[model samples]
Target chain A: MTLFDYIADRWDRLALQSWLHVSEVVQSTLLAAVLGVLIGVAVYRSPVGSAVATGLASTILTIPSFALLGLLIPVFGLGPTPAVVALVLYALLPITRNTIVGLAGVDPAVTDAAKGIGMGRLAVLTRVELRLAWPAILAGMRVATQMLMGIAVIAAYAKGPGLGGEVFSGLTRAGSANATNQALAGTLGVVVLALLLEGVYFFIARFTVSRGIRG
Target chain B: MSDVDVTGLSSEPGLKRADRVRLLAQPLAVLVVVGAVLVWAFARETDEIEAESIQAGVLLTKTWEHLLITVVVTAIVVGVAVPLGAMLTRRWAKPVAPVFLGIANIGQAAPALGVLVLFFLWTGWEGLWAAALPIAFYSLLPVLRNTIVGIQSVDPSLVDAARGIGMSPRSVLLRVEMPLALPMVLAGIRTSLVLAVGTATLAFFVNGGGLGELVDTGYKLNRPAVLVVGAVLAVGLALVVDWLGALAEQLLGPKGLG
Candidate 1:
């Protein structure tokens, strides 16, 4: 069958799968951003704590996606649970590291001035330091998002959702009719999705970062 | 002759002898821990397999094969990225550099597995080079960008001084620019090497034969021991490779800038 024919035949299912893929990426990245930021904030205040946090995340980053997914299968017993877990763990390094750098990078004088204005710790953090650090944090999330887009493909090995399953299925069916098409479609889907996300990030960055600091 | 203050030029933070030893021991510690795990695991799994000899061979051969793929690919990436990167940074090539960088960015942006599988399918020739070539392509970005950045960031006055002494452009680049860029170039290589180690595992998909086969098969067969051992070994190898890069950085990074 021609590639177009295959897509036509599989369009509905492909659409569902594509949606699943995007949702999975969104859920995973959001969760990772939250947790990674918390970890960064918790540790960034102390040099030793930041070091340990960075070290732990870096160690986790070294583990191959294939192996990490494989290792998780038995523990999490496959499907989205293990896939999301591994993605979260993998995503942590960039986000956490970026968070620590971003927050700590806020000018001390700026923060002190904010504090001197009677802004409580929470107000200053939420309104001042975090605002200055938002761009860096977003940049980290971007890296994590892109990294996981590739990695989530491996999640298919654990029976997780995403275009990866389609690709893996095509790979396993390699000499079969239209298998290459299937694989190509899946691979293209992932790359396009990743680029689109980047586009979205650019849009967000334009609006989210204040004009003063956009430079 | 570079007069770059090679002393104190080194950016690696100074370390006491004891601290250096402790840092260096990290991989050794990983080795010990992994060895113990292997013993316990193999001891437990001996009952499942027919012969101890086969398991040992499988482990060693897979590891060697994986290392071979990684090294060959990373070397190829360095060979290509450095020279190509240098050329793009040349005066005549300024306008075209962004195009090359964009291509490199796509190579990096594409999922590595997709790149590998796509190449495998296109070539339809399974084995080392087929897999190695695509991975090398994927990993070329870091070295290329670092080489460009390193060269561009070199002190212009030094290049000027060399040229003032009647040195050829090539001589000036080799003597002044390249040396200044060495640290960043090496750093790029280090990143590529670490990435290559991780990406090599997917070579199994193309039937190029590597540690991934062990992990993949172990998973399919529900042999957790084989899976764990394979995963641990890959992680260990990655850590070892990363440490080696760090060591190279420490020893070879601009010297005497201390």
Candidate 2:
């Protein structure tokens, strides 16, 4: 069968896989963003704290996804639990580092102005600092999403939902007539989804970024 | 400040206190963790299945395979990307640099496992080359992008100064541009090395045996000890490799720049 014919036949299954893939990645990215922003806020004021946070995050990033999954499987067992945990851990580094960088990059003068205007410290932070740092935080989410899209495939080996199942099935079913098509579908599906999300990020930046601070 | 910088390449001029602490701590941590894991695994009473895969010789071979794949992939990435990046940054090649980078960026977006599996099926080749080639492709972007950025970031006045001093274009490139770019290039290579080591774990899927084989063996046979050992060792190896990359970045760059 032609590649197109194969995809057409499996369109329903493929579509479901694609949705699951995007859903998990988006969920993980959002979770990481919330936690990361908190960590960034807590640590951005102190140089030592910032260094430690980024250092720890980067070290986590250095661990292989497969290994991390392997380690998690023993504790979490084989399912989406292990998958999500692994994804969250992997997603943490980028989001956390970016959050710290973004918050630190915020001008103290702006915070001072907010204070002069009778804003409380929390108000200054939530209204002024995080607002200004939003772009950087969003960019971090974008990167984390792109990364998790690929990684979610590996997570599929642990029985996580996604197109990676197709790839694994293809590997196991090598030499079958449809194996190539299955793997190609999974691989290409990821690339396409990644590109689509890239566009979504562009639109997000356009709409969400304040005009005054937009660059 | 591009996608490459997402890896958090250190652009600081000199080793700071934190860098020093991390440099000393990373390898030491890896050693302690790996050593403790090995001792624990060995000290455990293993059944036949666990014993089969968790033997000393077997672990060593798997680790060697993993290291070999990492080394081979790193070699290819450096050899291909550095020269190509340098070429792309030249005056005549400037227009097409973005094209190359664009292609690589898309390549990066693809899953590493997909790349490895796809390459395996495409060529009908198995083992080391199958694993290394696609991984090299996957990890190439960091170094390639860094090299171009590194060379392009060189101040034009420095080049002009070199030329005015009667230095040949070749010497100017070899001496001034390359030395200035070395730190960036090395930082890129460090990122690439970490990436290569991490991805090499997937090499087992293509029958290119690595620590991942141990992971597979443990998972398939339901041996938690074997599985944890495999996972920890892989993590330990990556940390050590990254530490070495950090060391190289510290030591290998032109001394005057630091």
Candidate 3:
């Protein structure tokens, strides 16, 4: 069967998998961003703290995703839990590092000006520093999201949601009718979704970046 | 897979305290963690199935296969990407450089596992070449990109000076541009190395036997010891390789550049 015909035949199931794939990745990216930004905030003030935080996060990145899944399977059991945990861990480095880099990149003079204007420390941070650092933090999120897309595919090994199942099922059914189509659909679906997310991020940056700082 | 320097190897150029600590501590940590895991796995009681997969001979062979795939893939990536990147940076090749990078960016977006399985299906091939080929494609972007960026970032005035001194273009490229670009190229290679090692774990999916096979075997057969051993060993190997890459970056770059 032609690839187009194959996709058409399984359009509903393919659509659901695509949604689940994006959903899982988006949720994981958001979760990592929250945790990463907090870590970045906590550590950015101290050089040593920033180094340690980024160091540990990058070490996690070095671990192969499959191995990490294997390590987690025993602890988290199969399904989305292990998958999500692995995705979050993988996403942390970029977000946290960027958060640190972004926050640190903010000019001390700007913070001092806010202080001189009678803003409290919390107000200075929330109103000024974070706004200025939003672009870098968003860039980090962008990187993490792109990365988690591929990883969520691997997470399918643990019976995690999304297009990865199609790839694995296709692998198992190799040499059979429609196997190639199945794998191609899954693979291409991810690439397409990743591109789509890239657009989403573009719009997000457009709308969310403070007007004065938009680039 | 656009090969971000996830490991932060290039984040700080000089030997800061953190770099020194990591340089001394990473391999030591790998040794301790991997050794402890191996000892625990062997010391534990096991069923026949677990014992079969967890034997020293079996573990060693699997680790060897995993390293072999990583090495082969890294070699192919460096060989292909370095020259390709260098060519793309040439004045005549500039117009098409983005085209190559665009293709690579899309390739990077395609999942590594997808790339591997698709390659296996397309070629009807298996074993090392099957695994190595697709992975090389997946990991090539980093080195290729860095090579172009490295060469392009060279100061034009430096090139002008070399030309004014009667140096040939080829010699200028060899002695001037390349040495200056070495650190970036090496940093890119390190990222590719880590990627190749990580992706090599999936080689077993294509019958290219590696540490991942043990992972699959353990997962399939319900043997946590086997699974942990496989996972830990793969993790350990990647750390060691990354550490080695960092060391090379520190030692191999041309002097006086830092």
Which one wins on TM-score?
Answer: 3
Candidate 1 Cα misplacement greater than 4 A, ranges: A1-5, B1-29, B50-54, B256-258
Give TM-scores of the second chain, every candidate.
Answer: 0.88, 0.95, 0.95
Pairs with backbone N, CA or C atoms under 3 Å apart (clashes), candidate 1: B6-B255, B7-B256, B7-B257, B8-B256, B8-B257, B8-B258, B9-B256, B9-B257
Ranking by DockQ: 2, 3, 1
Q: List, residue by residue over A51-159, the lDDT tens digit for candidate 1.
A: 6676667667767788788788778887999999998998887788778778877889998999898999999988998888888888888888888888888888889
DockQ comparison, 1 vs 2, better candidate: 2
**CAPRI grade, predicted model 2:** medium
Native A-B interface contacts kept, per candidate: 0.35, 0.67, 0.65
Candidate 1, position B17, lDDT: 30
The candidate that wins on lDDT is 3
CA shift at B163, candidate 3, in angstroms?
1.2
Q: Compared with the true structure, what per-residue lDDT tens digits does model 3 show for residues A1-215?
A: 99999999999999999999999999999999999999999999888887788777877898999999999999999999999999999999888888888898899999999999999989988999999988988888999999999999999999999999999999999999988999999999999999999999989989989999775
Candidate 2: regions farther than 4 A off: B1-4, B12-18
Instruction: Write down the RMSD of all candidates, one decimal each.
Output: 4.8, 1.6, 1.8
Model 3 agreement with the true structure over B188-214: per-residue lDDT tens digits: 999999999999999999999999999
TM-score of the candidate numbered 3? 0.97
Ranking by lDDT: 3, 2, 1
**Comparison by lDDT, 1 against 3, better one:** 3
